[model samples]
Target: MTPSPATAAVRVRRAELSDLDDLVALEQATFDHDLVSRAQFRRHLDSDSARVLVASANHRRFLGTALVFFRKGSRVARLYSIASLPEARGKGVGTALIEAAEAAARQRRCQSLRLEVRIDNESAIRLYERLGYRRIGPVEKGFYEDGSDAFRYAKTLA
Candidate 1:
């Protein structure tokens, strides 16, 4: 039986090595031709400065994942990727993962959280804007594989 949203238990926590496969699968499902390989996922899992969070429902199925990197000198946190499984979209998994990342940034004394979203992803753009992120600039041809431009958004916590 499929788990219903009402009964689904969504947990957002720090991702471990064991979650790499699910993360990669979700990445592949979320983005076209921009999926991170297993090697890259392992590297991120081993990195100290990288914060990866995963959301799961019913303690079994992976719902979504978010990856963020911390910058030392500038104390800025950059959100590298935030992807949710097709079944988890619009179900608050992405928002929960993002919130967890922001909390981590706050704990690390990061001044702000910044991320780039493809200009054509209207739903994601709307979500970020609603979450208090302000677009500062555009990354010209930032997404090479698909030749899509990216819009940079930042949310200052301090």
Candidate 2:
């Protein structure tokens, strides 16, 4: 059953080491190849500049997640990943996770937020546009090792 917005029971919070399995599963389900390894995820979890946020329902069911990395000298944060379970799409979980990431970036005094979306990912592009992100440029093919073109987007927070 889908959870309502008021009682969605979905909470967005920092991912702990124990959440590695669920985070990896969600990443694999959302992307093609290039799935992040457990070791990579653990490293991010332990890093001060990287963050992984998870959205969970009923405090147990993982619904979605977003990964962000902040560059120390540039004051620019990159949104590395944002994905929601297929069944959980359109439930506002992705939005919540993104807003959380924005808050986190702002907390770190980031001046802008950036991300790259696959050229064919219309839904994600629309979501980012609606959230005030604008396309900055396009990266050539083979950017993802899957030959998918990527569109870069950025939003100035400061």
Candidate 3:
């Protein structure tokens, strides 16, 4: 049976242990040397402080993933990782995931969301800027495994 276009539209939801392999593949596809290993994904999957979300078409075709970390007794949530598959770039997958992350944070009583993006990621920077996230601090040198610098971005949720 053919699937409806609406059904195929990217949908963002919490990641599950069953999505381990897909999440790992997404990490590999999204980053080079600094890939998060399977064990790390496993830990995040089980962690109370972390929320792993995935964007998929029809709930089966993986398109992207986002990992958010929350601290107990803290109002700030960190967007630790977010990436869209190369084939899914510019298709609104990233935006959907970001919106989902923000909703999750707000639901958890977080007052704001912060993330670090590589300085060279112009597209991502543009997306964040368009979404109302602002640069908050000095550049973080050698933040990535490949020695790339990063820029911190923050968005108030309240």
Assess candidate 3 and give its TM-score to the true structure: 0.91
My TM-score estimates for the predictions, one after another, are 0.88, 0.89, 0.91
Candidate 3: list runs displaced more than 4 Å: 1-8, 58-60
**In model 1, which runs have C-alpha deviations exceeding 4 angstroms?**
1-9
What's the best-to-worst order under TM-score? 3, 2, 1
Q: Whole-model Cα lDDT per candidate?
A: 0.81, 0.84, 0.88
- Local error of candidate 3 at 89, Å? 0.8
Query: Could you tell which candidate, 1 or 3, scores higher by lDDT?
Result: 3
Would you list the rank order by lDDT, best first?
A: 3, 2, 1
**What is the Cα-based lDDT of residue 18 in candidate 2?**
81
RMSD of each: 4.5, 3.7, 4.3
**Residue 64: error of model 2 in Å?**
0.8
Top-scoring candidate (TM-score): 3
